[model samples]
Target: MRNARFLWELISYRPASASCRTLFMLACYGERIVFGLAIQAFFNTLPQHTQMTPELFVLFLPWLIAIAVRLIVVNFGTIGAVRFEFSAQALLQHNLFKHILQRPGFQALPDSVGNTISSFRDDTAIVVELLSHLGETCALIIYTSVVFIILLRVNVLITLLVFLPLCCIVVLARQAQKGLEKYRRASRTATSNVTGAIGEIFGAVQAIQVAGAEQHVVAHFHTLNAQRRASMVKDRMLSGALDALFGNVGDIGTALILVLAALSLTAGQIRPGDLVIFLTYLAIVSDFFTDIGSLLAQQTQARISFERMTNVIHGMPDHQLVAHHALHIHDKVNEESAPPAVPQPVVVPLQQLVVRDLCYRYPETGRGIAGINICIQGGTLTVITGRIGAGKTTLLHTLLGLVTADAGEITWNERPVADAAAFFIPQRSAYTAQVPHLFSDTLRENILLGLPEHEHTNDLSTAIHTAVLDHDIAALEHGLDTRIGVRGVKLSGGQIQRVAAARMLVRQPALIVCDDLSSALDIETEQLLWDRLRTSRTQTCIAISHRRSVLQRADQIIVLKQGQVEAAGSLEQLLTTSQEMQRIWQGSE
Candidate 1:
């Protein structure tokens, strides 16, 4: 029943296309039946004869014509099926990608990258094949029904004998299906683990080499690979066993029909021509049963794939941010006009930002921020500082709606922070993680992602300058056109951070939430970046930084101790009253 629902979902992707393919499949089956009748006619024309007469030649003509028609219909049917498979595969991949992107954030994804990739590629392909088999299964049912009716008319006893064995095959096949499903699911999971391990190892190849842990990594990979191989072998062995059993059953059924026909012919109960037609139809019936067995076996694998993909597409915890309709900032801009005259880029500002006793805990460890309260005024700089493991990053993530809060409320301009109507541009609230990620693309493309090409020129230049990345761009051979390589490997650590900063800047967000934006930058560059940011525009800046320069410039400084706010005030005020703040200040100096 679950398999039926999965099949229906796949067909519903493009019902018209599926219908067309099914029609062609039916035509192919019809041609096969006609070909069998043609053979029966040829036998009737030449029964107990040796000479080739004009009438025999005429019978031969229909047989030849049936072969020709079958060839054409089979070709068209194959073409239609291939086209449908390609289309369905493409749609499934697109939806999988979109669904992954719409997930709350990276933390919500499957633990292993390989597992997701398996669903995206291997599982989707399996489901598409399942769709093809399902269509063929339907066609085979109709073909088998017509052939059985013909056989019954020719000799009811022989048809009944063939039908009883097939019912037994069905019962046996069902039992095998349960075991096949369990093994196939295990095999798929093991394969995903192997894939994920390989992906992770390759991604961190440099780290492995640097740490001189090549042997250890390979050992772990071999363990996963061995598990995959064992599971796959078991799955294949079971499937082959079922295939052999079904094939033998079909052969026995064929032999029984032939034997029955011989006896009937000797008894003068049926003509030789009638025997010929019965044998031909019986062959079709045997082939149909064999196909049904194969279909059932494959169905188990497809069901596993379908369930894996469905979980990925639907398992994400509901995120209010994703539910909110994206506000197109470009739509509000005057596209025809020249760039803005302001020397410093202008950003849309949040009217008021408020957080009341927000609390969130990590699911695994049950440790996170608690009773965190702070007010962020629009167009001001708010800096959060603390020692390691103080929950600064967690607090930032909670405010950005990347992680769900256990309790408390966050509002912007008297509206719930998650409300769609609260802001026209969600990009107005941008976040830069502590470790910035860069795609393997041109520098300009990375900075201006999702923005129109027209908006890229002047805004990109301004953002590059603001992030202190202009010097790095100037040093490159291709300037902004240079491909940065994976994770910006070609650039220095500081340059990668700045590129991420520039990306956030280009959006001209009303609120900029950055985590350790200057961690990789030199003291001088860090000072310059913050100085420029401070005087640039009225955009509210909330950042986690330890730099004395940033602390001095912050309008409000939040000092966290463990998961709770230890101090909140102007830097000087905190330095005077809080021992933790004093210690942090002294350490920085």
Candidate 2:
């Protein structure tokens, strides 16, 4: 009953493709039935030896024609099945990626990308084999049932004797099933481990080199490979044993049936030619049933693969609300028409950020920020400082809507940030973290991420100058026309950071929240970055920094201790009035 529901759901979810699958199955079954009946009729008619002349040869013509039709139908069904598998796989991949993009932070599902590749690349074969085997299994079942009924018509007692041994086959098959399940689970885990390792190594090649952990990574890869090899060996050993045992049993049954039919003929209960025909049908039935058991095992493994793929495709992530609002960003092809005006800012009230008894917890570890309350006025360069793991990053993530708060309300301008109203710059800078993805095009094209229609070519030069990267690009061969390599690999860390800054500035966002992006820069460069930020009037900057020089320019400072606010005020007010703040400044001095 449960299996029926699963098939129904699968069909409903993919109706158009399911129709093709149904046609494929029907064609396979039609061919199998026609072929089986023809084979049976051919052997049964051979008992009439008296009239077997040249005219008797005409009886075999229908059998030959049925065999040809069966081949054509089966081939067509196989082709159709393959096409459906490919289309379904593509749809699954697209949906998985789209779902991940909607997930918060996206980093939380580190294995999602690996799962996608494994499902379509590695697991697709399993699905294809499963469908193919299922068609064959269905054909075998139909042929066996028709032949079995014919055997019963000849003699009920003999038919009962034949069924007795099949009971043993079923019991043995059940025992082998346990082993198959164990190995199937092991193989899936090993596959996922290998995929994850490859993705990690390739994605962080630079980090691996800097850390000098190449050998360690290779060693881990070998471990996963060894596990996979061992799992395959286990499955093969068990399957091989079952195959040999089942074959031996089938041989014994065939011998018994032949001996009984010979005895019946000697007793004058049946003719010699009838025994010959019965034995022929017995061979076909035995082979069909034996193959059924093996196909069932393969189906078991395919089921495991299906479950693993679906879990990744269906898993939920944090901050994915019911989506009461939407900020649909369509792919812009070119900048021909006037760029649409940036949508009007979501009008908000209170002129500040309000947090009421907010709480947040990590997925793996329950340890996260607890209840807290605070209000931060807009237009203030608020700086938050705390000890390591004191929830500074967590608070920032919550504010940016990267992580969901366990219990609390964070209202921006008296309204929640339901859409892309603000920009967030993580601690590593966009280039260092996001890899500064650049196409093989001009520098000007790369800077304009979406190319707002209102934007002009001059905006590129303005952004470069404001980011203090004009001299750097001028040193390049083609200036703005120079092509950046994939992920800007040709650029240095500082250059990548500056380029990312320029891209962000091109949007002219209302809010810029930087999480210590200038840590890698020298004092002068950092100072210049702050100077450029000051030139914008309406844009607000909220910085998270512990550096004394960085904090000196902030209009307000908030000290966090043990996940709770310790002090909040201007630098001068905190230095003279708060002991902890005074000590921090004195120590830095």
Candidate 3:
């Protein structure tokens, strides 16, 4: 009884679909009651010479009716509950995904993508097992208990004798649960490690191949798999031991009960029919104890899976700020209209960006830039240059309010952008990612991304020309209407870069931030792109680049070293005055 209470507490603690759970529990009890009564009726009806009264007939009829009703109800209820669980899993997966994409480039990564996929596919499936298996376990327990109660009424002494051994087995089984749970938890961790390692290897496949480290990676993967397998083996061994121990003890108890019955029958103390019924009930009682062991093991497994899922759901960074701002955007746009049916913005933009003593730390690693300050004036092409991993990417992220700056106040114009302002083009830009995620989508529709039914006339021809994509696109059978394949794989690297550039250019945002995107282009192409970019009016551009050709066009060149600014000046000034710049130029060229 205490074990049952604990199980119920576990279920209720993290209840999924309360109404469904309640119905499932009720259905379980009904099933057990119906089955117990049916078994009892079969015993009573045997040996036709025994007196069969009207009350017994009434009892027998109801038991048959109840079992039939329970079968239908339980089957339908389980199906509905499972369907609901799957639907909820799908919704959660979708929301987690969309949330990550909305994050700034700083927080985006290859690992986050894999984690989301695993959570949806692997994690959710485990949770479903918890629901279905746990439900069935509860039903089995109730059915077994009902039979045991009937056995007790038939012969109190024999009933107590059987239950005493069953009680000992239950106590021993519960003791084994703690060890099983530990192994189960280890198994889960090992599995996660294997998954995480595989995700990392796949994500960095290019780097691994370049470094010629396939053997090393495979060896590491094997070790992770070995650890996971070892944990599973141990868990299974412990579970098997519990099962064997319980089965043996129950067998002995059954033998003892049978001997006592035979002795009683020999002495003419109990009828043959009654002794036969006692043995049948004894079997049911033994099977129930075994089921209880199965239930406990399953519950432990569910607990492990639930704990893993809960960690992820709770580990995600808060989306509250984004939600608030999205609401703010709607509010501001709507306030200008009569009746105020839409949301209104309470803040306006002056368009200058100022960073005062900015600092940023990677959330998990606690390693990043600190004590940085810069001002980005409107209407100039500002370039940030740095050695690899020198916090160039971090700075761009800091400006966009992506990674939370540890100690910095970034204000737009004079007002802080705890409101709204900039659009950041990450280091990889839209070129490498699924942005403007091409569909069977028209070029116009893809670019506009559902702006409005009336707002569908945005032509990319001029922007395409500016981005040097005119010639390439014109060769296509449908020109701008040509379908770009998934991730734009059908396009060359340069062509995809140009299309992405064109997409960003067409937006004409107040601030355009680019990161290391010009590294791939030839000198002439880079120069041509810059000439076109120079024509934009009243928009600030900040680009991170290593190429001298790209840097020549910058109004201000900020050089970073070891997460600090080595110098900030024009290209000519940097060449003459910055030692790090001189070294980099001499070495690279």
Candidate 1, superposed: residue stretches over 4 Å from native: 48-50, 60-79, 107-111, 315-348, 420-427, 586-589
Of 1 and 3, the candidate ranking higher by TM-score: 1
Candidate 2 clashing pairs, residues 3+ apart or interchain: 339-453, 339-454
- Candidate 2 achieves a global lDDT of 0.64
Global lDDT of each candidate: 0.79, 0.64, 0.65
Ranking by lDDT: 1, 3, 2
Worst 10 residues of 2 by lDDT: 318-327
Question: What TM-score number comes out for model 2?
Answer: 0.78
So what's the TM-score on candidate 1? Answer: 0.89
Clash-forming residue pairs, model 3 = 331-343, 331-344, 331-345, 332-343, 332-344, 332-345, 352-413, 359-406
The residue-by-residue lDDT of candidate 1 on 484-540, one tens digit each, is 998788988899999999999887788888999998888899999998887765788
Candidate 3 vs. true structure, TM-score: 0.77
Give the lowest summed-lDDT range of ten residues in model 3: 320-329
